[model samples]
Target: MLRVAAVKSPKIKKIENSPPASPPPSPVQLARAEENRIIALAKLHQSRTQGLFVNVGPSWMKVLEPEIKKEYFQSLCKFIASERSKHTIYPPTDEVFSWTRMCTLNEVRLLILIQFLFFSVGLCFSVKPGVQRPPSLANMYQELSKDIPEFKSPDHGCLTGWASQGVLLLNACLTVRASQANSHKDKGWEKLTDAVIKWLNSNRSGLVFILWGAYAQKKGSFIDQKKHCVLKGVHPSPLSAHRGFFGCHHFSKCNDYLVQQNKKPIDWNMLPAELMKENINIQN
Candidate 1:
């Protein structure tokens, strides 16, 4: 015990010589940072809201990225908190519901793209889910066809035009209408007619214009000149038969002309054969 040497004291570094380390950001701090970024972007541009449809932005897309899933969470919060969340665009019908499920499972982006495109063009705008049309486009279509006996066929309506084609389809329809508009005054019939004609004149060629019914026929003069071929005569309404609008042979003639010009056969048989037969029978 007496032989023990004095223990040497450990050298300690002076506090002034020590290096400082950065502090970690708290969760609250990180969340606030993200919110600030999103808010700043939202201020730069606000998307338009149609009935039930919400136009998502690139920021929203970024938020959905798996790495930055926080953005998605924030977007969901914003969307759900917004008044538009309560709306429903689809019907209760099992068929439409089933289609919606299928679209969700397969082509969510495609469906959203379509709605966005439609909103941009000002046609068939979406409403909030579950919100019914006051006069409803369907009701309006029914009313419009009420007096037109030829439009008695289930498929012979405006809604059919909306349902059968993509959002861009209406553009084709409108183009056909515009090419025929001789003057600004002719634009008075309906905005859609004017839009169609304008679109057609700008994008000519490779477009097939179907001019059904007397109204379309009367206004189809310009389209007749511009299109590869215009299928004219009665509107495929059942009344077309009694009105002598069908069996003009223009349908087949136009199809054949298109084949000759384009070096390809026109598939006028896109619709069900039975529907085609019904149209032909009514016309005859």
Candidate 2:
């Protein structure tokens, strides 16, 4: 064996020039990064509002039930974020996923679900989740008040008042573009809302569900009619409200069912004391 000297390779110095500034992120990549950021923010919003929300939407939102913290809700939030960043148009208060927090979670005896955030009126007036005074809502208040007399008419503060009485007001499709109906349909919101409905039907007993319109009624099909009361009616939209919504009497019917179930009836006349007084005076 001939002795051979091994040549050592020269050591090259490492050069780090800030990694080319990441190529300034291509348009597609910038778009993707933005999408990821949106998703992260949406997820963060969900996390921050979890377990008895710490100031998410309004005073009402702060007291939302623990449902907001569930896995289904988190998944929905991520999907919504991703979808919105891609193409879906979100409504005004993207943070308020559902109109929950009428009362403690356990106190909820009824769930009211509509198809989507009916934004027909939202284009004209800013919709502040718990404070929206759309014509449809006003019609509901009017009709229900006419029937029950105690159910207060729609005023500036009546929306929150109604929510504070333990009715979980939810929309199957949570968001849509302004003036566009069901624009956000099939965008993964149904799963979350459906899960909420199913959870209530299974875990809780003697609950009342008011499923307005064909879409909500369809989504509510899985509810066990044997365990809960499911009330179906035409949506209270101006287009079809005259067809059946006017006489649906869902408010009284919901209260009646609650009584039958031995649950305290939701006082549909949920106006604050002062507002109630003013309302009465106006009527007088």
Candidate 3:
């Protein structure tokens, strides 16, 4: 057997140029990227300027014009920043003033307009000094429960239940100086709140107003009585809850009005299941 020797041909190796070095980004491309970044920042500023913060929920914001919203947000931030520099403010500058949690602002059927919110309490209606007296809010809750038997009391200090039931707990003067009531009064909150009430009155119908104090009643006075229901009572503070707030069947009457208006009555008894356990734990 003869073995044939095979001659291997010299293979030419082709050197491939590396992917053209990805052509260093053109000046135009870089400029475009910078422009995009500027545009993105501008959008973010516009959102904040338009009061798109979650705490300033869209429901209320939608009622006011965008210009009004922008002015209000900027002015409020300016005032808060200035006041905070001088002394301690009740609601820290960082926290958004709304105490509401589960509210879907568009769905709100009732408005609870208050004069001024308490300072840093977390729970807006949680009255203090439990040993000396029962929490006035709790007393009011009892009255509500008496009328709507299934109404779950916010014993856990969470207003999620009330908020979920479409009750908006709004304060006219959202900020106050610590230990000094009405310190922030006439600082433009009046104008903003007035606008909100007037807007709602004109645009929406079949809504209910629970004006708990003289101030709140006065604020809601312009509300069209024929188109909506207005329930006025003394302030629910321990000092005044006894005078008229106790006997006023506002809860039941609110539902009655809703029924008459052909709108679904709020299930005052409905509370989220998750919050139920939280309520129990807080009690224990």
Per-candidate TM equals: 0.33, 0.63, 0.68
lDDT tens digits, residue span 126-155, model 3: 332222223666677778877787776654
The model with the greater lDDT, 1 or 3, is 3
Which candidate ranks first by lDDT, i.e. highest?
Answer: 3
- Point out where model 2 deviates above 4 Å: 1-79, 82-94, 119-132, 272-284
Off by over 4 Å in 1: 1-49, 52-189, 224-227, 269-284
lDDT of 2: 0.61
Scored by lDDT, model 3 comes in at 0.64
Query: Between 2 and 3, whose lDDT is larger?
Result: 3
The digit string of per-residue lDDT tens for model 1 on 1-284 reads 57988999999967676577878999778766775765554444333111111222222223222312234334432442342244431222122112111111111111101111111122232222233432223332343244333433233212212222211222211111122222212212133333434444444454445555555555545553554455554443344433543335543454465466654433322322121110100000
Please rank every candidate by TM-score, starting with the best. 3, 2, 1
Backbone clash total for model 2 is 0
Q: In terms of TM-score, which candidate is strongest?
A: 3
User: Local distance difference test, per candidate?
Assistant: 0.32, 0.61, 0.64
